[model samples]
Target chain A: MTNSQRTPYDGIVMAAPVTIPYVRYSIESAQWWIGRALGALVAQAGIKASDIDGLCVSSFTMGTDSGIGLTQHFGLCVRWLDTIPLGGASAIAGLRKAARAVQARDADIVACVAGDTNHVDSFRLTLENFSRFNQDAVYPYGAGGANASFALIARNYMRTFGVSREDVGRIAVAQRANALRNPHALMKTPLTLEQYLAARPISDPIHLFDCVMPCAGAEAFLVMREETAASLGLPAARLLSTIERHNAFADDPMQVRGGWAMDVGELYAMAAVNPDDLDIVQTYDDYPVITMMQFEDLGFCRKGEGAEFVRAHDLTIDGDFPHNTSGGQLSVGQAGAAGAYLGLVEGLRQVLGAAGPTQVRNARLGLASGFGMINYDRGLASGAAIFAGPSR
Target chain B: MLQRCEACGAFAYPAREACPSCLSPDLAFADAPRGGVLLAETTARVPSDVYFRERVPWRIGLVKMDCGPTIVAHLHTDCVEGAPVRMSLQLDKSGQAVTFARPEGETPNMADDRQWREMTADPKFRRVLVTNGRSVIGQEAVVALKAAGAKTVFVGVAEPWRPFAGEDLLRRQEGVEVVTLDAADEKSAADLAADIGGKVEILVNTTEYVRAGGLLDRKGTSIARDEIDQAYLGFINLAQAFGPAMRMRGADGINNSVAWVNILSVYALANWPAFGAYSASQAACLSLSHCLRAELRPGGIKVMNLFTGPVDTEWFQTVPPPKVAPRAVAQAIVSGLKNGLEEMYVGDVAEEIRQRLAANPKALERELDR
Candidate 1:
């Protein structure tokens, strides 16, 4: 099989990034959160409610509701409607599908929305019956949810690559520092490297700060052709390139690299950019170890050099790297599928110079990557999309 | 047992319908090579569910097998990354198959390992309650429990004022106390439970009333009635009395109440004409144990059923050789308790019946009478 030339995103652009203010726990259902987010997206775009002709919804707590269900609930009638079930990769994956929809003229504008409501016990309930493979094989062992599995992955990756707990602690500490600047981040207090190392382990190798807090919220954005955005005079971020993969590197005994490693070369090739050209990067960071893996796999550093890369550079917004500049999910609470969208939305804000306090200086180019859905041992979905400032 | 794909020759776990590798529909479920290396492990200090949360510091790991498919398994404390581990499929309290990893090399205090403790009901320093002491099987159970390091073994002697043959020796044995109780009488069971219910870590019910006769040979329901009282009704009395207390203490320290044992006959699977009344009673108790398991599972208590062949006792004088001895039953009970096995078939006849029943239930039922 030969690789075919990829289609360019061309005139497609993303605009009107909306975050529906996360809360620790919400008495309201996922419907309320999604409705609020969709409402906010329309208001921010300064468009009529019916302007969003196509819809793509992503959520975990909406029960039986998907994109189709939301259409009736929100009175949406559109040509193209779908849902992304990729969990932490939901928004990035939704971006790929919606971008193609708009490029192919399926709809004039597509609203990509991800939301989830976190009740006190909903997180545990979701984990208890996460999936068939998980419930049958993983949950029965210790029922530690994702924490236990990632601990193993983290421990193995550290040993395999000669990384240390201190190196892993650096990721969490820096993210917490970045979180302090973002007023909406769940973790408000300043964090130090010492506190990260001293934090009691949730699962060994994964400390308290390494894990994301579960919260209720929604994130949304609009995908449209440049002509459509120009007519409305909306400030939008141009889509440079994107890549998506599932269950990649199936033969590796341990998940040292994700699908990003396999397709990262093409990602940069399609974007017509080098790794050094990016001004900002946002990696799906449910855990600090995963962030390290992403940094190495996404071409920020060599495979075994992620530890040294973190040590050599600071990761806070004002620092040299400025990765996860909007605090990521490590500081901002994980809002189910919205956790996947956090990076994409934050990346859009940075590229468009729309980020307030957490904005990167003179941000022109950025990348948002996602990894999610641990059906059994490791996460299956991997995706990334480069966002640039409307091609200058 | 793991499934092997015939087309791709790759191994798949968790009983899949089609091959994960080749998408081959041709698959065989058989015992695969148990060799595997521990990839990573975590002793989840914070568990997700109440069942595991109560038993905190629960260790689990990722194990990629010599065959294929990485599995999440209950890991022994000694299971370290890059070290070899042997895997086994054990039935949990819910009667579902779960993988467990054991160290290839012997580890110190192996029985004390959390993984072993989770899977077994080892009678080490835990209090035990035996519901009957009149039969040879009952007497030997007391002796075995004491040898297995039971802190206290309470022997329930019905109508203790009327002494049994081994009454003097049982009372004289260290850590063994004879208590007054009658399985047939509800008050007797309740009284005994009220005294020692909170402390009984393991309960062994060995009350069996047997007589030689088919349903047609029996004139009245007199003999059948006695068998039902001792086997079926008596079991109900003990379970009702002691179940709640054991459940409440299921997650208490090492001395926590663990398992309830039932001595059953393999003939319960298929009735034996010669001992029709006895077989019927055994079947009834076996059915009830399944219900008791579900009820006790929420509290993490286990209801283990021990199936045995015809025992060599006065009641089986007319039967032929190849009978299970009382001592053998006692030994099986102790070992099964240590293993925390839900079902144990003792003696050649019991094992034979179990296999035959699995292969062909209807055929075994027809052959049992012959």
Candidate 2:
């Protein structure tokens, strides 16, 4: 691919996420959450909803409605539209699609939103019919749900790498401490290592703290030309490089890593930056073990040294390795599809100097990685983006 | 059965129509080897479905079969992670084929094989008969059967003249037929059996004679005799009466009976001396049910034995805390029937007792001795 085709957008101007929390049960539908995110995007960007010529949306419970239906419902005549259902990887997926669309001049302003509402039965129903493979293979075995599947991976990771629960517990406790500064975070209470270790096991090897609390929320961002963002006087984050891979390393007996391992070199090469150069790192923290895996796969550490890396680094917002500064989904509450966008939006916020209390000092360049869609035993989609603040 | 791709020689689980590898439509089904290495295991303390809520703390494992396929299957309690397991295919409650793995040399047809029982649990459109309908558990069973879409529910009353709390409600419900029969009386049981044996698809014996006391109590022997007369003889009479007809029906291909459920107590598994005679009678009943289960296995009629602890009923009004609600037990029975579980330990106390027995029987025995 040509450089223009590869790094299409001059920059991405992301809006503050419209997050709704603690709605463990909601009467509203997926459309309402998506619309709310769109409203927030337009208001934050100081643009009219009608000005949005490109639309990209992601939701798990949207039910037969993709970008086409969303366009009609929101009364938008878009030149480009995409529906990313990549779960945690959706935010980066949406950004990549919208960025390419803008570069191609298909649309000037693209509104990319990912949101979902959690109802009493939505979580269970979603798992039951997640996929034919899950329904037939994984679900029937004790109906262990997602926790059980992740438990298998966590156990194997520990056994293979000699990682202890204390090593993983450090991530959760640190993230909880970070969530204390995030007003939008659901779990603001201080989490001690003792508490994380003692928390009841949902599935063996995965405790309550190890699992993400499913809530209802959304996050959105606006992608447009550099001239457009400059005219609006909005601070923009330059999209240095983004990479996505699916079903990578399908031969592993159990997932000790993700697709990021396969493409991290390409991502760093394209961005012209080393892993050590990034100011802040935002990883998909669906589980602490996954965060450790991302750190290794994204080239922050050597393979099989994730546990050692985690043990050696201080991961709190103010620490040496500023990671998941906005508390991540672990504390922010995973709002269905919004989980995919959480890290990307946070990365944008960090680069733009909008991350209030959890802001890393002198934050300039940031890395955001997403992993999602556990089709059966392991997550299939992985995407990451490196963003740089606009030149002073 | 597992599917193999003729083009690439790759084997796939769930018997897919097309090859996942090589994109070959020429896939063929063949018998899978009964051996696999247990890759991982988890004790699911939380359940995601309504049917599994009562059966929490179930062991599930991922097994990599020797034939180049991995399957998520129910693991036998004896099987641990990293151990080699023998695999067998069994249908789940949804009528979908599911693999079950057990420790090697443990026959899949063993009496404690839970996977074999789950295959027979779905109670949709099956005709049901609940013996001893006067009690709370019996009434709940009838209600659960109706909710599960049983075509017809026959409520067998041992004492027709006695007043029961839910008896009138049961008689008033649609599709419920109340019949009179004394389980201890062979003639009455035979007469009732002759009446509805052909039509009954799910038979549940909830008869119990519990006189709570230790062996030192003056009336203990009489209580034990009555318990034996009612619990054991009652189950035997019902099984003998229904087993023949159920087998014949299975042979006839017209409404083959699905299962026979016995609501015994957890004490039967590990004799709790506090309820000495009651426990002894329940133990006898449990043994008889196993024999009956084996006898009816050829006809595909599952025998579901429920081992529950103290339930919230008049029989256990004095039993404090940790008692299971009658509706919960009833729901469990219906779920058990639908899932075709051979043996189910319901209620928190029962599950605790089960785990205790599995972990250290001598410790449990010593505690009971105290």
Candidate 3:
């Protein structure tokens, strides 16, 4: 389908991006962090908890509970509700679902939230039963979880494109530098290029710094009619376009490219922008290789030119190209499904002039992309969203 | 086993419900082409599960099978990225099928690869226990295990005072150690366990009491009772005595406890009227082995069942020709352990019965009855 056939996301606006601060480990459950994010959203939007008639919840550690159970746990009623378990793709995917609900008048306000608690052993437990394909086909081999899966992808990508460890290090080093400016990012120390290169390997070619630190946290944003947001006097960002795809290119032996490449032409066409038009871009950074894939697939660079693109452009928040302005998941810490929304939340804040220390200058237009779910050999979900300042 | 979609001609792994391409439910199991290319590989230093954690630094690979599917396989150290490779399906410690990748051509010490070593319970350098070495099959099993590199073969000669033709043959084997234990006596098993249970790595149960009579053909239940005591009850005594020690030492260094071998009969799948009581006892032992498999799975210990057709021993002399030899059955057991196969059908008749049972159980049941 062409981009012209799709209806524009005209009146819906995303506002009140709330991050519940990542902790290396938490004694609390997923509900505790999700509840905090929801409460934070209500207080930040200056609306009563009951005003949100819709909810979109995403989490990996929510045992025997979903979006429906969450409403009762938090004491509210909703006309529209959903629970997205799409790991790193949950944020953009959840936002798109909430925006459509608002446009259809099914709910006046929809709260899109994702959260998970890392209880020291939760990451390992989650990987054990992540999916049927993963358990039967992938885990039995080495039980290496995502680390081993991504290592293969990184190694293949490096060999095919002649990308070096230094190229990958550049993305990580810049993200760590951006993390230093992000108050809520879990990594507080500065990182050197030498440190990233010299970091110990968890799986060959995937060093300690190349991987994200699993943590406990939550992120939430509200999707409502632009008029409703204006009436509430809440700062907001307008949705230009959003696209999501699952299990695309299942036949690719090597997953160096993601689903974004399948419909990227339409994503940019509907948003009516070129690659240069994006003042800020936030690509999911579960690993530095993913960011490089997003750069190639999202039209920031040609296929196999991700190395050249990162080499030529400065990715720091104050540099020529400001990417992952909130330090992304690699620096902020991957909080289960909350990691999926990391890039989208940062993109929304940037366009709304709300990103405090890591805000890009004159960030009027922004793009966020997500890739996730290594169900077996490779990741299976991809999504992206373009957001613009309310004035734009 | 590999599945090929009838509609789209595509191959799928992990047994898909429908064709991955055309969404057709019509799928056929076929032998897969072994050819494949190693797309990528890694050495996992940190494992998500405890079973692999003990065997850290496991080699893993992603391969694009020549047949059409991409598979995640255990990698041999010789398997290089972007190089041609071949695949084999080996049962992991869980007794579930896991594909493995190796070099296209044979490599030196391929069997010594860590992934291969972990999956296969090769008797190499590990201690073993063979029960009731008085039986021809039992004595042969002790010999086979020793030839496969077992450091010590503890042959349990039940009723030690009773003279057997092959008793001297078993006692003279280089690595063979004679121990007195009666399969029917619970105390004997316990006494043996107290002596060597802590060190026995592989336990091969080869006790059998064969009587050629159906239930209705026998007036008294004494013959049936003896069969149950040897095949069914004797299994419990051995499992209880040695199982705990073996399970506890699953992750104990390189020569850790690995497998429990159950020598059973093909008749266990479907009873033969000629030996109904014996078949029933075999069936009961098979069921218990499944339970033991689950219990020992967490420790990564394998429970391998070697099912053979009618043996050429005196008990099966009246049955028919093509009966598997006791020495040959012993060789099959060692081979199954080396290949990490959970269920192995040895000999022509055993393999034929296995195939017929899979294709049509009711037909095989009727045919075996006669």
Candidate 4:
């Protein structure tokens, strides 16, 4: 809790299983998946579950009742707990929360996790069902899922942000190309602006390819005091700083501009860092539109210059700023809760010199984010976490 | 194309005779703009004996008109939930209804979907099943699911069960499983419950049994059946059979107990029907939901009920109605189940009910003939 330079705490260990249950998502599965993943991490790190002092989880489908209840079910003896409800942003938020707990001496070791139902039908259910966002103003208007609604926002974003339809397509194309190098990516096909634009639009500016595939999976990590991490001989990453805010219905009242993008500056400030200091960054990208906005908001490049960044600069490992080296949600296969964690894991591995192919060279610091609860016409609820290299 | 009524401030699809709000005969036709969010959509199955079996599992949607109104339009692609749709003037194949397509950058051409095909075709997999009543859409969804290579069974729920009956429809679809239960009484409910003692992967309850006819022809009046208590029996019976069956199965499988789908007119949820008995019965059905949810949570059951409005069925066809379709209602219900929802309000009526319930708690009692 210092100025621009926040003191380093302990190293955080993140872990997760690669697979998502194909069946419909349920509370039991959520707890099961999370517990299994965490158990593996505990064994790897050589720590007892009870010895872990804090727990944090993020999931779109797991409600509060289910999230809190999972603690007892998982048999985690922890003094602190945090449940994050943002869609793709959950993992990053959990990390930040764990960082705080570690810094506060709330716990010596913290576990962060995510999970979801990978079933396509259930994906359909999550959208058409009485979602947290669409219970009222949306369903009656035939605004189906986040894709359709975000398309509307993307349409307006393109208009307001001065991004050409090609620019959006460019992002999709580039991400797909980047995903090709990552084996875990869902989409690896090389894409072009022509192919992107030629594709049929699900909504105005949003194309089918412009959105990430609905995936179900989980990811996790462990965070503990730096001294303890080294003493245990565990690989680690530094949690620099974090921040979270809820902007429900920000667009409805027309009080705010760019729901998720609105607070990029604030997020950077909370982390006591700027977009410039990061060697790598991971934004919770359920859609390409949100991805572009993250760049603009996070100060990676400039506002409405996201498309330019993709086209002009190289975000690939060989390029200037490395992004979604794991192919991101676009290619990385978004398994809901674990997706963000996957990004964080990849980031940590890069910083730890562990990523085999998708690694950003000489990576020392990384920033991760999660955005969720697409209320009204925008995504107001978001969480951000900044991480630095494991102190030598 | 559908248009919003100048009088009622609501969207109307297929152009209607009068404003459903005010009895104004000043109906104006308007085009449903392309490029609206897909609020909800589903696929449906047709009997082989039916003429449109080839189109059996097709996609249809409750599209929001960019202007204001909402219409049930055909979803051209296999994409149900997140797929964006561009409204356009197309032949309403079903009954002069308008349709739309994906706009530019909306969807990739079929050939470009090589990766999607490769991913979908894997045997070990992850797959999602989305239904459409139209065979074209249904086939597309199936193709997509198959291409994803996930073990998927996307069943299309058809509309109008009375004339053909749910059992008869189940009989026609070979290799498909069926859970039959009456939507009107207790004995049938018990029988259905016994039949489905355990084996069930996904349990969806979409049975609505209501004796329709205005309670009062005039501005306000009362009708019987409110005291009869027959309607309540169907819901309870079906829940007993299916809800428990899902619980018995695996906690991971989805259990959707959808009740009160597209049967209400404006008076039902809000106006406080003149038929107090019917209203009371339906209200009671909704009340039992809380307890069932609590009891089933330990079993990992995800329960969702549909509080839907009018649907275009044999019942609605005979009576004048809004731009409602039976197929549309079915699609929405299935979509809700996919998102892991607990409750879904099909149309604007849900909001109307909330308003009435919050604004005037006693407004529902006005229908009582007391």
Every candidate's CA RMSD = 2.0, 17.7, 2.4, 16.5
Q: Rank the candidates by lDDT, best first.
A: 3, 1, 2, 4
Residue A155 lDDT (model 4): 58
Q: For model 4, what is the error of residue B304's alpha carbon versus the real structure, in angstroms, after optimal superposition?
A: 29
In candidate 2, what are the lDDT values of residues A1-392, reduced to their tens digit? Answer: 12323543455444434454435657898898888888888788888889899999999988888889999898888888898888989988888888888877888889888888888888988888888789888888778788888888888888888899999999999899999999889886899999999999888889999999888888888887777788887788877788999999887878998999988887887778889898999999999999989989999999888888988999988899999998999998988989988888888888888887888888899999989888888899999998887642
Tell me model 3's lDDT, rounded to 2 decimals.
0.90
* Residue ranges of candidate 1 with Cα displaced over 4 Å: A1-4, B6-9, B25-29, B91-96
lDDT of 1 by residue, B1-370 (tens): 7888889888897667899888999999877999899888887888878777778888888898988878888988888888999998876655567898999988888778866776778898899999899889999999999998899999889887886798888989999989987999999999989999898999999987888777887899988888888889998999999999998888788677889999999988889888887899899999999998988887777888989889999999988979999999999999988877888999999999999999999998888777
Model 3: clashing residue pairs?
Answer: A88-A340
Ordered by TM-score, highest first, the candidates read 1, 3, 2, 4
TM-score of each: 0.96, 0.70, 0.95, 0.52
Residue B116 of model 4: what lDDT? 21
For residues B1-370, write the lDDT of model 2, one tens digit per residue. Answer: 7888889988887567788778899988877678998888877878787656656777788888888877888887778788899987765544356788878875554533544444554566678888878888888889998998878999889778888787779889998899997888888889998888888888888896776776886543666778878889888888788888886554343345777888989988888887767888888988888798778876667778888998887778777888988788889988777555677888899999999999999899778765
Candidates 3 and 4, the one with greater DockQ: 3
Best-fitting candidate, measured by lDDT?
3
Question: Taking the tens digit of each residue's C-alpha lDDT, what string does model 4 give over B49-156?
Answer: 122233344344455556655544545554454456666553121112234434325555531232121111121232222222222223323343344333433333
Give i-RMS (Å) per prediction: 1.1, 1.2, 1.0, 10.8
DockQ top scorer: 1
Top candidate on TM-score is 1
Q: How many pairs of residues in model 3 come into backbone collision?
A: 1
